[model samples]
Target: MATQYANDIPFSASHDQQAFKLLELPPELLSLLESEHPPTLTITSSKATETTSGYALLCHGDKKYQMRQKNTSNPIMILAPSRTMPTESDDAETFISSPSVTTISKIEDTIELILQEAEVKAAPKNKWHEKFAKSRAEKKK
Candidate 1:
């Protein structure tokens, strides 16, 4: 029978400590959290686990929201108000104001309008066929 030694088991607590540290909210996010006051928002940096890729956690009361970066190299910031629910946690004192449906709809409409404007601005000024025709006419002259 082979004797198993304790040293054979690779047990280290450093990884957990590092993961906890990684989850610490950044100062910029904290400032935004204070300014926005979205009922409750807790931002945390996540490490890739077995099931999913690394993502940021945005907790609003008892409800949890995960924010996955579309591009690992460049991450975009998104701010959205969330409804708060009472929880039996130490941070239960945090309260959030819910926006009315009308307000949300107006915001959505404004965003759609802005996106339409941007699309219009980004469209090509001259069509390829038009340019080709103009060049052909010039060559004929």
Candidate 2:
């Protein structure tokens, strides 16, 4: 009876086809799918080689996606979020909470202070000497 039940279920190539489909998807499409499903995602790439390089697989939501790059030079692709400046008419002030806004402002002020300190510390004390030495060396060459 158990053997009969096992035989009753027919194996289909759908899963294999699905796996193949997953491999061919781009990172953008994979990210969109991951955002929608919120599944565990894993990315793997082939080791540096002549022909096998630039091939990467993204595994997520029980599906695998394959991506091939035009060249093997760039092993990793990074997608950065786009930043937009808020206009006067923008309703971001209304949408964002006060606490969050305050936190963001504080962070920005801290970063600005750190950058100012870095710039002050990085200023060359012997700027004239360094520039004159470089120019003298170039004239000699």
Candidate 3:
């Protein structure tokens, strides 16, 4: 049982093998899965060869949101925190965490930074400055 948070990355509940094969799981998710105390509920799974856009799993205490296209589905599902039910004032105007562009962008940026760190750690000899130096040398040549 993992502590699900708001604005967390959403995951698709796919059971198809093809979906997982095509879905690009962010490095962060990979890292989480590898962690010793990974959150069981936050784990993502897919079924189709490719992932679908505009979908995520909203998990609260016991509520699970299943938003998907019944016809053609993809595996690029996200694991996000559950949102409160919409109210009259919140209808189409209020800004809550759901399938939104801003939230997605933030998640992507965080993933990129995690990946950069991982790369740097994996390649101790090739620092960012050293890579820049190599590029400069090649350009000069």
Give all candidates' CA lDDT scores.
0.42, 0.41, 0.41
Model 1 / residue 49 / CA error / Å: 2.1
Q: Where is model 2 more than 4 Å wrong at Cα?
A: 1-37, 46-54, 70-141
lDDT of 1 by residue, 1-141 (tens): 566663242221222221111233445545656785646555665568688687665655544445532223332223334443444653655654343211111111110000011112445676888999999999999
lDDT of 3: 0.41
Candidate 3 lDDT by residue in tens digits, 1-141: 566674465443324322122223455555765799865643233224355543344232343333332323322434434444455767566657454221221111111111111112334564889899999999999
Error of 2 at 20 (Å): 26
Off by over 4 Å in 3: 1-21, 42-54, 58-141
For lDDT, the strongest prediction is 1
Model 1 residue 29 CA deviation (Å) reads 17
- Single out the weakest 10-residue window by summed lDDT for candidate 1: 106-115
TM-score of 2: 0.21
In terms of lDDT, the poorest run of 10 residues in model 2 is 106-115
Against the true structure, what is each candidate's TM-score?
A: 0.21, 0.21, 0.19
Q: Which of 1 and 3 is the better model by TM-score?
A: 1
